[model samples]
Target: MSWTSFYLIVAGLLAFTMLLVCWPWLRRRNSMVQDSLTNVQIVKQRLEELEREASEGVISEHDRRQASDELKLALVDETSLQKEGSRTGVLPLSVGAIAALLVGIIVYFNVNQLDKVARVQHAIDALPRLSEQLAAGKSEQFNTEDVRDLALAIRQRLRGSPEDARGWMFLGRLWMSLGQDVQAIEAIERALAIDPQSTATRISYAQALMVTGEAAKFQRAQEVLQGLLSENPENDNLALMMAVVSAQLGDADTTRQYYEQIKNKLPENNDMLTQLAGRLAELENQIQDVPQGSELDTTATPGFTIEVSIAEELKSKLPEQGFLIVFAQDANSDNRMPAAVVKMPLQNFPVKVTLTTDNAMLPSYSLAQLEQARLVARISTDADVAPSPGDLEGELNAKVVAGQTSSHTIIISKERK
Candidate 1:
């Protein structure tokens, strides 16, 4: 309701209450005035009777005069008392009404928190306009102060309505846009807690986590994306984010798998996909130099030795004229280019390949320098570096400690569509 209308209603109620309280006092005052008038009429009638009796000689003139004086004195006393009573009654009523009004005003202001209510109302009214402006890409129209005010308003509203998930989500996004990552994360987390099944909230949470650029947060983002993907496998946008996160964490096979899922859905020559393809190619080249069938000191070179196998149900689908590509990429770098890669003609089941610094695509940044790397194994129907329909792939993430070698297995169960 508008403040004007609310104020009008309150004022009317207060006036009606005051009237109800004073009505009885006013009625008593009027009754006292009527009684005083009646007493004066009775005294005048008695004086007339005494004069009539004296004229008829029923009593001496002196006695008659004495009775008349006494009657007049009694009448004077009664009139004075009645006037005093009227004054006393009115004085207290006036005082009480004034006191009641003052107390009512004080309580209304203090207890009602009218100022806070006004602020909240103003904010509620202004929000849609501001949001519309932002949605229309006119965020430049709003200054920093405007955003701060809006945020404060939302907070005040949330204090009264803590369960509003959409409010929390909007607040989180607003903070994110302002580069307040911690606040953004906190707000988004609240939204997720309130409504765990909200896809938008989960996506926002993952984005917030990824923006922190911390390994732990990235891992969390990966888990969130994985959950979302499980629920919505056909969402190309989610798949795209999953691919990016996987690449950032150096999970080459998962990255490639996600990338391929969205590749067909996106426009040809998309820049993001092109960049991903280049990174994968670099990773493939790095794995090409690892030696085979020789017992080597694993401690001297840190990398992964992977065992690749085909799923039983898909064995009949394997192409006779195909090549196997195995690659590893640095997990921590934003560049995401492969540190090592190996490619060979398709061989028998349970193919074994090793990747190390010796297979580095670039000597400047090799697997030996990596703290972690992602391994991918793919069997493609053709020798092209880019994956095609019917390619089988799998991936794993492994630590690359200089004094240790990691071993993992990849089951090429998923086929590219």
Candidate 2:
């Protein structure tokens, strides 16, 4: 049964116990009232005796009357009966009620503690957020390396043969984080193939397509998403993805409908909600022509570049981005910030860039968590701005730890279009 149901059941039992504890007292009060009426009859008999003596002339009326009044007062001051009956057993009953209440409280606390399911969910929620924190560098305020380590541990659980779809999806996202477009695509496709019914997987796939693939591929991704929506329009995950894609495609009404549903449906504390809201605002601007859309042609981007200058000793076993933006992630966390990004900038590929993870960007002596993070960067670029795009190198992920700079040296020479 649910916690609420258990609580109500306990409350009802305590209320019943309270009634039982008071039952004896209620019975005693009734008995005392009945005994009081009996005393009244005894007093009447004494008054009648005094009247008889006066009628027989055995005593003067005044003297007999005085004796009768004195007897009546004596009865009132100190009842001739050994009865302190009403005071009995009240303390024990009161003590029992307090005991019952204490027991109920103990049960409540213990049962709450025993809810293993709740604890598991709490852990799950925390794991994702911790990963995000590490990526965003929020944990830099504390021991960020620890957060990075934690992310790696969680990711490890998602691995091992007989992969969980959730695990593969997480890894795919992590690949995106490390600026490894090719790996990201592989991981995401693995997840989709594992669970085609999952809208979550499809949306993740679409994000990759939008940034990494060609226009034709972008259209195909949109079609895949549309087919999913046709199966279940109200699917919250699909609705959220469609909202952004629709806005990107310049569909105002449709995007707004999805936005409205998202406001009511998105899980509290989800990062996606904020991203969607910001995008929705931009879509509004696009449709309303509020100051009109910028004439910037991001389509001109050629691609991005990266450089892996790890200490020669630590240079091997490195992952690189080619024709794709690559992302390296903490194997344990869902974080993407601690990752590095590079642009490919050529052959209509994802902004591909490269960087060395373990040697220079990371400190000589790394924090414990970063050691396990499988250290990497993410990559992406604009198509409408080539040549220069190819020359552009991505930022360093050293920002994961506070007080660190994020600048990088030129990784590629600029080539004129």
Candidate 3:
């Protein structure tokens, strides 16, 4: 909700409350005024009657005079009493109204934490701009202070809107961006709890679990990915993540199984298949060692020498503390998980990196498995696990020949949207 709307609602409630508190006093004051008027009218009518009676010889002048004085005294006493009652009633009502207003102000400022609300609202208002700047690779536009303020705002908002799954997810992503994996996991778990049926939220939760790099967390991530894969068997992304999780858990058999499932679906001579085959072989070699003099076969490994550069016009947009990621994946597959990947701090343009079986993201997947692959070079300002908006990226399809290192040039010409 907007701050303006919140403030308006609060003001309206306070006005309604004050009216309720003062209603009885208002009614009583009006009744007293009416009664005073009625008494004056009755006294005037009686005096007129007395004058008529005296003139008609119904009473002597002396008796009439005495009656008139008594009547006037009674009227004076009644008027004075009514005035006293009015003053007495007004004092307490005024005091009560003032006290109630003061208490309301105090409660709004203290109990409700109006100052924190204002800060939260300010952070909320600044969100879009902050996101835009960050996405644009302008890290200098924000700082730790800005992030802290935003985190505090999200926490405060969640207190009042605990059931907002999207809000929780947003907070989780924010924490992830800040490299707070534990907090990110907690937040995404909350989102998943709120929306158990959301595939995206579940995927995010699993990713957070995997980021911790713990064996137990890897098992948990595997479970989550397996569950998702069961529900949507055709989802290559889930299958790929499952393989990675299994590899992380040291489950070589499961990793190879998932690898083969994905590998079989690709076209013949796919680049990822070559990488996967070499990685699978390596996994097997780990279980059974060869003779001391015998060396592991390197002929099955696929290699790529990548030359990465940026477009001339986009050079100025490069981030100061960015990373260059080069990876090879199956050319025709919808899955984006790379069979082999390399990450290095971005320093200069025309940077060269070599990808081999050792660079495989999973132990059972490597460049040796594919005949044709999509070579990608990306400049990630935030070091995100996946490509995101404002990140510069370039890709080209290349053929993979086992035992032969291919050279390719990738020009980072476009920003991811």
- Going through the candidates in order, what is the number of backbone clashes in each? 9, 57, 17
Over 1-417, each residue of candidate 2 has an lDDT whose tens digit, in order, gives 566987799789878878887877888767767777787787889889889989999889899979998978877754534255445466677787788789978887887656555654454556766767668978555353343344355455664543678767776766555444555667788888889888788877877665542333445566777888788877887777677665444456777888797887767667767766665665465445323258743343221133433233322322343333343344443322223233343332222243333322222112222323333332224322111222232323332332232333322222212
Q: Say which prediction, candidate 1 or candidate 3, comes out ahead on lDDT.
A: 1
Best by lDDT: 1
Q: Please give the distance, in angstroms, between residue 242's alpha carbon in candidate 2 and its true position after superposition.
A: 1.6
How well does each candidate superpose onto the true structure, as a TM-score? 0.48, 0.31, 0.48
TM-score of 1: 0.48
What do the candidate models score in CA lDDT, each in turn? 0.79, 0.54, 0.79
lDDT of 1 by residue, 1-417 (tens): 677898799889988998898899889878878888898898889889998999999988998899989988998898898788878888888899999899988887778877877666777778888878878999888876568657867877788899999889988887776666677889999989999999999999999877754445767999999999999998889999888777656567887899889888877888888777776665555456444567545657787789999899888988888899888865665564567778899999899898878776555456875777878788876554344556788877788877666788988888876
lDDT of 3 by residue, 256-346 (tens): 9788778767776876556556556656775675324547675657788989989998898888898998888877543445778778888
Worst 10 residues of 1 by lDDT: 381-390
Clashes of 1: 9
- For candidate 2, the C-alpha RMSD (Å) to the true structure equals 22.6
